[model samples]
Target: MSPFAMRRRHAFAAGLALPFARTAFAQGDYPSRPVTVVIGFTPAGLTDTMTRIIAGRMGRELGQNLVVENRPGAATSIASAHVAQARADGYTLLMGTASLAINPALQPSLPPRDPRQDLAPVGMAYESPFLLIVRADLPIRDLADFVAHARAHPGRIEMGSSGTGATNHLLIAMLAREAGIQLEHIPYRGAAAALTDLRGGRIAATWATPPDAMPLVGDGTARALAVSSRERMRTLPDVPAAPETLPGVHGTFWQGLFAPPGTPEPVLARLGAALDAATRDPEIVRRAEESGVVMRPGDGGALRAYLASETERWSTLIRAANIRAE
Candidate 1:
């Protein structure tokens, strides 16, 4: 090629790279202003609480406030969609829950029908398991007894959950399928209401989060039979893992951070680093464990892999059980 032609070709290549260079430069100063982290559930819930803790620390790390705004509705679809549709700039983010995966599988009509495509994962925040608790007065003293009773009285066991298609509800379905028992699921507007009824003996059994279950378990208002995780909870060491009684039955309520799709890689790296550091913070870890949450902090790849596995796992269960959103 002629010298002039080569010079022109080099200029064209450089022009093509300019846009990318600009993006990197902008991302280098990510969060030039406050960053907003949207949550799908109301304040005070596990998701909200954890997000605030982690976001506060992350904000300090990033030198900008991470504001948490709740837009709870449609089982978290509203908040999720808002972030998913926002600009790919690092300013807007979502503190997504397991509902991110569940809503798509259970309610196909909801916005963000594909979490993997709509959101770019920053990192995993934390995870907590549901506690399988029964009425304190029941003869069920352990998971073995609960399973035997459930099997013996199949459809008679009244299992309460937060709501139909909720994570706990799906855990109920998983338990039934794995243990070959039938549970008459009683869906409440929220887990708090369900636990209230469980305490009142209105429901025979229900799954509750650790923070919710610990008080009742300690006070003898309810009996904890098993934990939904594959392993025992650190605080409740005596509560056997559900998988011990019914293998392959594991469930967790987890949260992760996400930026809108197409976010620049540099911005993601910065956010991921902040999140990883926050999760490793001693106070953050202590508070999380004390509240029955385990900090698993990981990078975008970890969150991506987790989201894919969870989506597939729950999608299969929802389809097999014909779960539908209310």
Candidate 2:
């Protein structure tokens, strides 16, 4: 064949293989390298602890390591912003918690980036209810009795929280609203201080996660009266669900896996699948349950929906309570 004819034949052959090549590249071994999971809290914190648990199994399922990186500050707004600004390549992700949804409404200084818009929810990891803990000597025994006492006492009783706009604060505010009473909510720099006060009989109550409250309850330092979940927590089955006495009060320290915005659908699907599988793993469930967490495994869309509902729910209470960051 002539030179031009030979060139045309080669070009045609290349074109024929181009589509297959593109397909292969698109479907290439995703996550050929390690993926980093970012948490907005310090190590050993609730968010970090759960992310560490689920990310390991997810890494195994994805055939790559899932590294847990801590960037705790500004009530997780800093780490959340970091993940929100990261490249949309599935390699960077956030083990986002309820704080991500709650912070925008709570922190006036936090430049607004709707988590629903800025980050891609990969999947739900797990959720843990806040236990309403009081000093063991307090007459409050269960949620109903607590509500009645708060109603009778009004602003006289003190309710403590981690911070002014924290989930614990929002939960207590919601409880106050539901009971038609006023609680003198005292905000602290950390749960430890609030818990310490509760143990010392300085504060009436504080909303605490299982990790923070269960130990105190176990040692008779505090009494768990109720859990802020719609239903009973399997780990704290003896405690009544707050919603039983006050309907629609389901506040939890829920967490979801997230990626930066614009991450491709296929990458998200893979991560979500691995997450769903790993979160449901029997050992993962057992570990999380042992820590008083309820394993919730779902897809990105479900996570998005959950975030939306949580944001609305928490924001309304924060506004109603006039909650602002300390």
Candidate 3:
């Protein structure tokens, strides 16, 4: 070929590659500014605390502070929608809770921006076990006693949760079906409120994460009847697992990192790596262990699969109970 022709062809190829090259560079230099991690609930809730702890480590690793913003409302739909509509850049992310998966099932009419489609899971932060805690003075001493009392009282037993269609609410609905007991479900603005009612003796029971419930239960303010996991919590060895007490009853709350759905794959990878490293941080691990949080460090694909299965699991029960986020 002639020299002039070769030069022209090379220029044409470079022109074609320019846009792709720019995108690659942008992804590589992600989070040139502070990244925001949005939480759907108030500060100090299980999800909020876990995200704060991990974001600290992740910020140090990425050389850019990960700022956590709480946008709690409408059962996390507010935060999920905020993140869903944000730029697809890695700068904005959601400290996604299991409620993201269950919200749609609970509030179908609320038009939740479908986290599975609107956000991309970066990686799991940690999984927390919820305990079925009752007012310490309730006429129940164990799961058996609680079950009998609930059966006897039927709709009189008021079981409170963070909110309608929340994990605890749905788990109680599932329990109603499995145990053939009637529970009058009470949903609060947040777990803190519901637990407050429980402690005040205004409510019969509530589902609280170990981190939030540990202090209250330890202080004799509440009694943990059974944990939601199949295995008992090491710290709460006296409490039996729900599945053992009542077959097929299980639920857990997990937190993950998520970005706008259209985020670049390379950016997602970079953030995922940061999250993986943060989850393994020694201090983070120690704090999580003390709070009964199980370290999963699950990646994007694992989180996606978990969302799929959890959605299906909770949807079935929600539909069965005709539960919604009213």
Candidate 4:
């Protein structure tokens, strides 16, 4: 071939590859700016705290700031919707919770772009069991006593939850169904307020996350009846699992990170790697343990599988209990 002809052919090939090279580079240099993690619950809650901790470590790992935005309302559907509509870049993320799975089952009329359908799991951060607590003055002492009391005084025992359709509320309903007992449910704006009412004896019991329940139980204001986990909590070993008496009942709330669907696979993998590292960090693990969260890290595929199982489990409970958004 002539040298001039060969040079012309090489130039054509290079020209064709420029756009593809740019696209690949763009993916490789993701998060050139800050990343925003949208949390579905209110600030200062367990989810917010966990997200901020993970975000700080993740920011350090990525050498970019990770901003946590709280959009707490509508049973967490508001924040989730925001992420679902966000650009499918790594910039937008969701601090997904057990509510991510429960919301679809509880609120069937939510919208076409549900979080379960619109968001993709990036990684899981931690898991924790909710504690069934009652005011110290309450006569009930254990799961069996609580059920007996509820059965003896149908509609008289009032239980409180952060809100309707929340994981706490759904778990309570599940316990009720499985125990063959009936209790009045009181929905509060948040878990803090519900705890206040329970302390005041206005409510008989509440399903509280361990962090929230631990302080109350420690102060002698409330008694933790049982943990809603398959195994006992390390910090509260004396307290038995709720399933001990109820037999086949078990539940826990999980917190994790998610991205809008269509996020590049490379970015997702990078985020997952950062999360796995964060979960294993000594400080992060210690802080989570102190906060009553079990540090459990899983990659994108494992997180997705866990979410699918949780969705199915909650769906069955919701249908069986005829639970719907209030």
Candidate 5:
């Protein structure tokens, strides 16, 4: 071939490569624009708070802004659905919890695509065990005494939760089923409202987040009966676990991040690494601890497996308890 012809052919090849290279570089950057993290609950809640905090750190790591949007209602199904249908780009993510897994089983009437099927788990942000609390004025001193009193009262005792099919509500319901006791279930707008009534002696007991219950318990406004964890919480070392009394009841609330299904594997990997790093950051750790959230980090594969197991476990419990969401 002539030298001039060869030069022209090479120039043509380079010209064709420019656009492809730009597209490749864009994908490699993963998040060229602001990333949105959607929460299923209202703002100022545990999930919302953690998500915003984690998103901020993730934004720092990725050199892009991470925006958290709260879409609370319909037991998180609304938010989950929004993320599920969003573009598969890593830009959109869901701040999921055990509720993501539990809701499918409890609300069978929910839309077709399941969160487990529509979302790709990225990583876990933090987890906090629930604390069983009663009014400060209640006579029950411990889990044993509470059980005895509930047994004596049967359906007379009442427990409040954020909602009927929430993780907190199911935790108490599971305990009731395992312990062979009946307690009236009262659904509130959120844990804060439920805590208010518990302090006013309107309810017998309610499962609360350690962050929400610890101060009140310490201030003598509420009494801690037990924690809903396999091991006792560090914040309340003296408090026993509910399993200590019921022998087998255990549950905890977890928060994690997920991308819409079909998100590029590389993008997901980058996000997972950012989450793992953020969870280990000293500042993030300090804030989470103050919120009574234990910093438990997991990568994409680990988080996905954990979500799956939680879904199955909650499904069995919800079925056994005959609990359904309207």
Candidate 6:
């Protein structure tokens, strides 16, 4: 080979390699500035509160602020779409809830039509089951009594939920199917409104998160009948798990961290590590336990698998029950 030909070949190879090297270097320097985590619910709700708690810890690990912003609407589709369409630079993320999986099956027209394809799973944040509570004044004493009462009334016991197609609402439908009872469903704008009606005795029952229900249960305004998880929670040891009464009836409200699709592998790893660390933090675990939430620290692959399973589970139930978004 001539000297001139060898020189040309080396120069061309370097030119092609330069761009690839630069891209890798850029991805390595992730989160050069503050990162924003968008929440799909209003501030002070269980999702918002848990996101803030975990974000604060993650910020310390990343050495950058994880600014949380609320964009509550369309059953969380607005926030999901915003983050899904944002730049995949690890700077903007979504603290997606179980609604992420439920909405796609429940409402096919929503902005984020396919979560697995639109967003990159960063990691699993936390999971907690819903609490089945009824008005304290009701004669219902436990899950058995509640089932018998509903069977007796048959679509007369008004059950309130955050909204139609919400996780808690789906649990209500699942309970009715599994227990072979019919209950009237009353949808509200949010859990707080449903809880308010339950407190006033306008609604017979509703499913609530521990954080939201504890205040009323503690004061004797409402009585907790059962938990929707597969097993009893360590914090709420006395509440019977729903599966004991009706086999195969279990559901949970879960949160997972996500980035826009096509995010760099290095960036996803960095973010996932921060999330795993945050969930395992001593204080975070303690607070989660106190609130009856279970911390599920896992990597992007784990989140992807979990999301797929949840989507399948909810989709089957939604279709079988003919659940439509409100």
Q: Write the per-residue lDDT of candidate 4 for residues 121-165, one digit (tens) a residue.
A: 898889988999988887888988998888899888889997887
Residue range 44-136, candidate 6, lDDT tens digits: 877788899999999998889999999988889999989877766688999998988898789978867878777889999999888999988
TM-score of each: 0.92, 0.90, 0.85, 0.87, 0.88, 0.90
lDDT of 1 by residue, 100-135 (tens): 888878887787878887788999999999999888
Q: Which numbered prediction scores highest in TM-score against the true structure?
A: 1
> For model 4, where is the 10-residue window of minimal lDDT?
1-10
Candidate 1 minimal-lDDT segment of 10 residues: 1-10
Instruction: Kindly list the per-residue Cα lDDT of model 5 for residues 1-326, writing each as its tens digit.
Output: 43323433454465456665436544676778999998888788778888888888988999999999988777777887788767666888988877787877887656323666667789888888999988777788998888888899989889999888887999888878888889899999778899888878788789999888887888898889899988887767899988888877788888888887666567788898899989999999989878888888899888888888888899998888888775
Tens digit per residue, CA lDDT, model 2, 27-74: 956888999998888898767778888988998899999999998887
How many clashes (backbone N, Cα, C below 3 Å) per candidate? 0, 0, 0, 0, 0, 0
- lDDT scores for all predictions? 0.87, 0.82, 0.80, 0.82, 0.81, 0.87
lDDT of 6 at 30: 65
What is the alpha-carbon lDDT of model 6 when measured against the actual structure? 0.87
State the displacement of the C-alpha of residue 133, model 1, in Å, after optimal TM-score superposition. 0.4
Q: What's the TM for model 6?
A: 0.90
| Cα error of candidate 6 at position 216, Å | 2.6
- Model 1 spans > 4 angstroms off: 1-27
Q: How accurate is candidate 3 locally (lDDT)?
A: 0.80
At residue 28, candidate 2 shows an lDDT of: 55
